[model samples]
Target: MQLEDMTLEELKRLRKDVEKAIETYEARQLSEARAKLEAQAKELGYSLETIAGVSKTGSAKRLPKYRHPDNPTLTWTGRGRKPKWFIDALESGYEKKYLEI
Candidate 1:
């Protein structure tokens, strides 16, 4: 049926369905991306479990200090919130350089 001929309620329902499909697609894409990242890390001599650094009891593993991009004067250990460096870099953006899995 033509969209113009559909009732408002029907249109809303269609929109909801489309949004749900998009959400599902996005979730699947994210899962794939994470799996790929894990695989790449493994190939680079890092285990996924170690990357996430979870203990036997499921506690977070220790993270090393990293430099902040926004404020070079500052450094972070990756334990707390997104460091200024990451936030700034993300805001500035860079080309998607994905490692092959």
Candidate 2:
């Protein structure tokens, strides 16, 4: 319909309807894009976020498995390279079983 043919109220309602249609189209487009990206990511065995260089915000902390004999605060989960405390203790005739928590 021509803008000149519509009253002020009709124009306002048309504007609102057009805005709503735009929002719906935008939402649908975003959903489709996300799905396509996810499918593309899965072909490489990764999520879209990871493939895009985004790290997970809620990465979990590792649980400690070994604690210092004298200081309970000093603990290691024994995942990566051994720390100085762990290496020193092993060098001083200490066995790995002794540090088990």
lDDT of 1 by residue, 1-101 (tens): 99999999999989866654543453345447667988999899987667776553536544333433223345454557865555664464421121011
- Candidate achieving the largest TM-score: 2
Question: What TM-score does candidate 1 get on C-alpha atoms?
Answer: 0.35
Q: Score candidate 1 by lDDT.
A: 0.54
State the lDDT at 53 in candidate 1. 61
Off by over 4 Å in 2: 1-58
Tens-place lDDT digits, model 2, residues 1-101? 78999999999888866654543453345446667888999998998778877665667555466655545677797888888887886785556766655
Report, for every candidate in turn, its global Cα lDDT versus the true structure: 0.54, 0.68
Query: Residue 64's C-alpha lDDT in candidate 1?
Result: 35
TM-score each candidate. 0.35, 0.42
